[model samples]
Target: LFSAVVAPFLLASIPMLQPDLQRATLNALLQISAQLPVNQTSAGISVTYPPEDAWLTSRWPLVINMLWSLALVIGLVTAVFAMLVKRWLLAFQQKRDNTLPDDVDGFREQSVGLRKWGVNLIVGLLPLCLHFAIAVFLIGLIPFTWHVSKALGVLVSTLVSVGVFLYGLAALLGHMVVSCPYTAP
Candidate 1:
């Protein structure tokens, strides 16, 4: 009953809508929108940007792009490595089961682990390489730092280098701890 009355009222009012009321409502909406935000698309969609921080807009995208590319490369490499590992595992299993000849290598495997090859190849090699690279690059800066301020620079550089090394070592240890549960071929 409520819907029947309200639906007819809405239909009748829509056809007989007052132009003055429509103009006033539109004007109010325009005023509100004008005060809302400057950033928007042509279709009146709102866009947002970092406020009060021009530095973040410039540097964040660069760092994000660098990390994205690194991750992409690492993922591709890991996928390939996983494929190889799957093949090796299949060949190893087949040889053990007497289906594959003992003289053939792992690369000659006909049936690799098709269902979960990607998961099985958890090499944990990329993070290790990145950590070591970061440690080496930071530690290698000690000589340049030594020239800037004799004692303070050397001390700071030494501390930073040691911290980076320990961080990398910890990361390596963590990787090994995680990976030790899974056996490799």
Candidate 2:
């Protein structure tokens, strides 16, 4: 269920990897900068490339790529984790039946019994993990919006910030209120 919710977000961010719009903008800037008059020192050496070009061609793309890569990794890992948890639960349920042999019952006892491990804790934390993956994807999306329009970028950044803050506050409150079911991931 959590993986299903995160799939759309993950899919939405996949196109950011290409970032054609941003590349075109940077290419245009580079062309303009190339046309600008060159700067020469008394030593007779010409410096044609602007410092901004170095940043646009290198650092800006690096930041965007790194963020997207991280988000992708987090989303994939969380999805795999959810699958593992589902499999574990299913295996436990199948092994729970009395039709299994005595030896198999001993195996189940060692592995899947209610008191043998922190299965309950793992189940409780799945939602929190899902939220974390989604947050990462949202955060990585900011630069893409910025590339489109500064105002849109600001709007998205503000909204994402507020949403993250609210999630944190809720998690903190859940911890503080003993009766609350939500706890830290």
Candidate 3:
């Protein structure tokens, strides 16, 4: 029973972690770059690439690839979640319609339920709002930190934002489902 209640919250944290992970990767790459050697030639500057077998092994490129992978994962998961939620909502609405009697009282009852759902929806939106605020703060932090640290902060911030968004969305959908209108003949 405890697990059931906590499970959703835990799952919701995944999106929040996304930003942190991204920042960490970015910071790591920047830190690696800071160690690289650069020289000025007569025509231009030359920088020796790290050997293929080096531990840093194309750090920036690798980080870039990882970032792309993360983006793809986020997109795919969001799409799947949206599709499932849409189907579930449609099914729920249909069920409500079938259960309700075609009368004024039924309409009134459904309206009341809708009002309650609306309240829940608003409450659910709080997390999303908080997420946005945090993101804004993180953006502000970018200029204050060293290049590598700024990247890390950005990654952390992004994860937190995504987590909050996912959690808020799921909570809103759950509330809507539970508070959906149904009436008796």
The TM-score values for the models, in the order shown, are: 0.29, 0.59, 0.30
Better of 2 and 3 by lDDT: 2
Task: List lDDT for all candidates, in order.
Answer: 0.48, 0.66, 0.48
lDDT by residue for model 1 over 85-133, one digit each (tens)? Answer: 6676676566657754553554343334433454333545634544443
10 residues in a row with least lDDT, candidate 1: 1-10
| Candidate 2 TM-score to native | 0.59
Residue runs of model 2 more than 4 Å from their true location after superposition: 1-55, 99-125, 179-184
Report how far residue 151 has shifted in candidate 1, in Å. Answer: 32
- In candidate 2, the residue pairs with backbone N, CA or C atoms under 3 Å apart (3 or more residues apart, or in different chains) clash, namely none
- Quote the positional error of residue 110 for candidate 1 in Å: 14
Better TM-score candidate (1, 3): 3
Off by over 4 Å in 1: 1-53, 99-185
